[model samples]
Target: MISKEIVVANKTGIHARPASMFVKTATQFKSNITVTKDGKTANGKSLITILSLQLVKGSNITISADGADAAEAVDTLIKMVESKFGEE
Candidate 1:
């Protein structure tokens, strides 16, 4: 498994739109993905699971992936978060 911690950068953090985008991105890879925050972990491919975390601006979370594309999946997710989900 591969993992990296990132801070939510978007103004609204991972709300509806962003959360949808994140879940979509996660499904693009074949790896098993999970996101954890403050001792809570959620399935990255599930909208309800992700939204339940209540990740907001400045919140810290660790994203991890396991599978053949683990590294790529983890890197892509980190980039997405660092890019503020392209919302600027």
Candidate 2:
């Protein structure tokens, strides 16, 4: 398993578009991806699960992955978060 924390730099956080992009990126990996915030963890590959988190700006989220390609998955996710989904 691998995990990394990222602060939401996007003003709107992981709202709508960003969440969609995240879900898309997650599905590209074979690893099991999960994102947690405020004690709530959601499946990264599922759009509904991510949307359910209701992540907002400045929120601290931990993105984790396990199984095959775990490290690569986590790294890609971290890049996405750092990019702020182009929202910031």
Candidate 3:
């Protein structure tokens, strides 16, 4: 498994549209992905699971991937969050 903790950069954090985008992108990889916020964790490929977390700006979470392309998955996702989901 590969994991990295990063702050939610989007001003609105992960919600609705951004959450959908995240879930969609996560599914592009064959790796098993999980995102954890606080004490809660969700399936990174499920939009419902992600949106239910209601993550907010400044929140810290860990993104992890395990499988064939774990390293690339983690790195790409880190870059996505750092992009603020285009809210930048």
Q: What lDDT score belongs to each candidate, Candidate 1 first?
A: 0.95, 0.92, 0.89
Poorly placed runs, candidate 1 (over 4 Å): none
* TM-score between model 1 and native: 0.96
TM-scores, all models, native as reference: 0.96, 0.96, 0.95
RMSD (Cα, Å) of model 3:
0.8
Tell how far residue 16 is off in model 2, in angstroms.
1.1
Residue pairs of candidate 1 with colliding backbone atoms: none
Residue 4 of candidate 1: its Cα lDDT?
96
lDDT of 2 by residue, 1-88 (tens): 9999999888888988999999999999999999999999999999999989988888899999998899999999899899888765
Per-residue C-alpha lDDT of model 3 across residues 24-85, encoded as one tens digit per residue: 78989999999999889999999988887788999899999999999898898888889988
Task: Name every residue pair that clashes in candidate 3.
Answer: none
In TM-score terms, candidate 3 sits at 0.95
Give the Å error, residue 5, model 2.
0.7
Best model per lDDT: 1
- Candidate 2's C-alpha runs over 4 A off are none
